[model samples]
Target: MVFWVFGYGSLVWNPGFEYDEKVIGFIKDYRRVFDLACIDHRGTPEDPARTCTLEHIEGAVCWGAAYCVRGRPEKERAAMQYLERRECEYDQKTLVDFFKETDPLRPALSGVIVFTSTPDKVSNKYYLGPAPLEEMAWQIATAVGPCGNNRDYLFSLEKAMFDIGHEDDLVIELANEVRKVLGTMAKEKKLVGSPLKPLKSQTQPQIPTVQLHLLPPEAVAMDL
Candidate 1:
C-alpha cells in the first residue's frame, strides 16, 4: 500500500519520515492554518506548551508536497513509527486523506498526512492566513530540533515561494518580518517572557456574585 502523508505545516521540511517523493497535493475544504495550538508533545497533558494550529478554510484548498517512501516492510514500519512520534501531540491519531495535484497535467498523487486531535487537545485553531511568523522565527532562531532553526523554515518557504513565482505579499512579508525579529532575538541572549502563556489564559474564568436585595411586591405578584 502507498503511504500518503500530508505536509500542511512544518512537516513540509522535517517530517522525520523517509520518502522518495514529495509532490504538491491539493486538499479541498482544508487550507493551511496558523492558529496556535498547545500540544502535549511540547508540554504536559494538562497544558501543552506550544504548537501550531490548522483550521479549515472554506472553499479554499492548500497546496502542499507529499513524500512517498521507497522501502521494504521493515523500513516502512520504521518510517511510520517516526510519523507516530510526531503524532504524539495529535492524540496518536491521523487520517488518510487523498488529494489532487495542482499540476493539471500530472496524475493525482496520494501524498500527505493529516492529524486530528481532540477538541480539548488543540489549544487554539486558526484558518489559512499568514503563518505565525513570530513563532516560526523563534523556533528557527532557536534551532530547537533536528530541523535546526526557524530561519531555515522561513528561507525554505521564501525560496519555494520564489520558485513557484507565486507572490503572496502576506506570507512574504511575514517571512521577512520573522527574520528581522529573530535577528533581534539573536542579538539578545534569550527571549523574555513565556510565549505559550498566552494560550493558557483562554480557559473560561468564573466569577462569583452575591445578590444585594430581594425583589419588591411587583416581582412577588408576577411570581404568583
Candidate 2:
C-alpha cells in the first residue's frame, strides 16, 4: 500500500524526509493556525516561538502537500520514524482524505496521514491555543532559537505559500503585525538606525528564495 503524509507549515518547506512523489493537495474540514508554541524545537523554553497546526473547522480547507512513499515497507517505516522524531510535539496522528488540487473532482489520494493535536487532545503545555494577533506577533518577533529567528519561520512559510500562488491572508496579516512589533522592539532596544544591525530585526525583511523540490510549480499552480 502507498503511504502518504500531509504537510501544511514548515514541513512544506522542510519535510526532512524522502518520498517517491509529492503533490499539492487539500484536506477538508480543517484550517491551519499558528496556535502552537515551539518551545523545544524552534525556540528556547524561556522564549518560545509560535508555530502552525491544524484545527478542525467545518467547511474549512487546508492547502498543503502530500508525500507518497510506496513499494517498500521499510522505506515507509523509516520515513515515519523520521517524521515522529521531528514532530514530537504533535502527538496525535489521524488518517484523512487528501484531495489533489490538480483534479478536484476526482477522489482523494490513498493513505493520507496528518499529525495534529486538538484542544481537547488534553491540554498541551506548549499549546497556546488562540490569542490576539498583536500578542502573537510580539511573541514571534522577540523569540529566537537554535534554528533561527521565530519570525523567519513565519516569513518563510508565507513565502512558500505565495510561491505556489496561494495567498494566506491570516499569515500575511500576522507577518505585518510581527514586523510592526519588531520595529518597535528594535527602536526600544536602541538597535535601530545603527551601523551594526540588531540580531532580531531585519533591515528590509525580504522574502528569502526557496527551491521547493517536493512541490513542483505545476502541482501547486492549480491551487491558485
Top candidate by lDDT: 2
What lDDT tens digits, residue by residue, belong to model 2 across residues 74-142?
Answer: 888899999998887786898888886777656477558899975642567767788999999988988
Quote each prediction's TM-score: 0.54, 0.80
Top candidate on TM-score is: 2
Alpha carbon RMSD to native, model 1? 20.2
* Prediction-by-prediction clash tally: 10, 0
lDDT of 1 by residue, 78-106 (tens): 88788777655455244545565445444
Off by over 4 Å in 1: 36-53, 92-112, 116-147, 164-170, 182-224
| Cα misplacement distance, residue 163 of candidate 1 (Å) | 4.0
